[model samples]
Target: MSTDGASVHFSELVNRNRRTLARLEGSRSLLLRRRDGEDLVLTTASRAEQDRTVVSAATRMLLAMARREPGSMELLLDLLPDAFPWVRFLPETDLHAFAVELVDTMRAADSVGNNASVAQLLVEWQHTAEVHSDPELLAALTTDHGEDYGPVPDPREVA
Candidate 1:
């Protein structure tokens, strides 16, 4: 058996399977089926990688919801801590991006008669941009930056 690129020979998976491979040890067995052939690979990521993946998915869903539901963006922003606890674990940049996306989605909805369709389009754009974005860059000009509401202090710091 041999391996190349981001793949491994099927035999490697078989050997690991025989040894009782466990994803809990930072590895996941993925069966790759293709027109040419099939192969199995072991995918691994650190705990931080796993956490970021989970957080990103949840954040996407929350963004989608905020876009889809009228006025829900503000509601989510108002009750972010209570309603979406996973948000607390997100990086400051991610938190900032989420807020920006929610606001953009809302603005995009304003001109369209069918706001739902506009919201759907915004979500699709978001998903597409996620594929192209650098994982470390929090905000890029990927989608519209929406509008500017001027500066404000951190809500927690405000007296």
Candidate 2:
């Protein structure tokens, strides 16, 4: 029943459900691997709730530390390059901005018990750094094309 780190194929859930359920007894969760879709984590309701609580607390503590101790923000800024090597491509000012936005987004996402936004934010910032790393792309993006475009459409309407 100790199936930590073991992955169960998606079909196993239907064909060998008892075995999979048994595996969850020893471990807090199980990995469900799928061929045509994203993998999933299977865990008890209580365990999932516990994880959400822990993430929320950790994010809150990080934000509090960053605000209470000025040095904590500096420390996070210093560690960002190591955590995200692509961050090095960003200018110093942009790096600081990214860190601040990242921390805020993390806290917000944790509060909602959904980490998708955090992942999205990281991907977006990484792409930004990638763009900045290429001088031609950066210049192209910054260039002002004075040509008049039509009025912007409402996002809600587009949706």
Candidate 3:
């Protein structure tokens, strides 16, 4: 695949969160689908033989950095050219643009933290952006469409 093109033949995007011992940080997930739309999760970071598969650069970069640099993360642009899935949110990007727009978005997020839609939209955008990179996850995300599975117990109440 051409590394410096406006498009990639195989594309997926995802958004997810990571759960640590006591903290949950923003993260992403992606999955691929066969021609018939059968979900196939692209084996990725920490998995054996992942390099031979087509995984999202975002997922790889995040996992790689997390190993030695706990708080460091490269933006989507920092990882590769615009053809990758995570760059979908960059509506008007150029060669000179900074990678991983999270910074700017974070700044804007801080500015509008009081607005519910602003924060939610940004989270959803980032999530989809991350998920879109893998086919299986993308297929699952698209198929789910925010359905109501059931109600959840209140965490604040003691049984």
Candidate 4:
């Protein structure tokens, strides 16, 4: 099966189930695009399980390497900029912190058979880098105002 899966409209699943399944004959997965909701992936259960197993083992190995070798973590930190170009905006200390957090989060998420936390962590750190890239925003955030504005509201409530 091809790893570069085919895309199909969400309605195809209901309107032409056989055609949709046929597309999967040459593809490892199918992307079901939705207009009002998040897109979905259709793949064989075995494939999904295999993917989880591979991710879990890779994350575990990476964590073990970082823990056993003194220079492994440093090597990983050095390579982060190439993997995530936005990380260049972060200071040296923050960059190191991000790398450590990322590996740890990936391992934890893999252990639980979920990648959502890893994705969230990456997005959060990228946003931090974005703020650091903006001099004015960085200055404003770092600056301490003498007066307390008010109590911070809950994000859920604000939303």
Quick one: ranking by lDDT, best first? 4, 2, 1, 3
Clashing pairs in 4: none
Tell me the tens digit of each residue's lDDT in model 3 across 26-76. Answer: 222233333555554432354423432333343344445534453343333
| TM-score per model over all chains | 0.25, 0.76, 0.24, 0.86
- TM-score between candidate 2 and the true structure: 0.76
Give the candidate number with the greatest lDDT.
4
The residue pairs found clashing in candidate 2 are none
* Number of backbone collisions per candidate: 0, 0, 20, 0
RMSD of 4: 3.2
Model 4 residue 35 CA deviation in Å = 2.4
Candidate 4: what lDDT? 0.89
Q: Give the TM-score ranking, best first.
A: 4, 2, 1, 3
Q: Is candidate 1 or candidate 2 better by lDDT?
A: 2
Q: What is the Cα-based TM-score of model 1?
A: 0.25
lDDT (10s digit) by residue, model 2, range 117-151: 99899999999999999999999999998986989
Q: Give the C-alpha lDDT of model 3.
A: 0.42
Over the stretch 49-79, how does candidate 1's per-residue lDDT look in tens digits? 6745665565556667777877876676667
lDDT of 2 at 41: 82
Q: Note the Cα lDDT for every prediction shown.
A: 0.54, 0.88, 0.42, 0.89
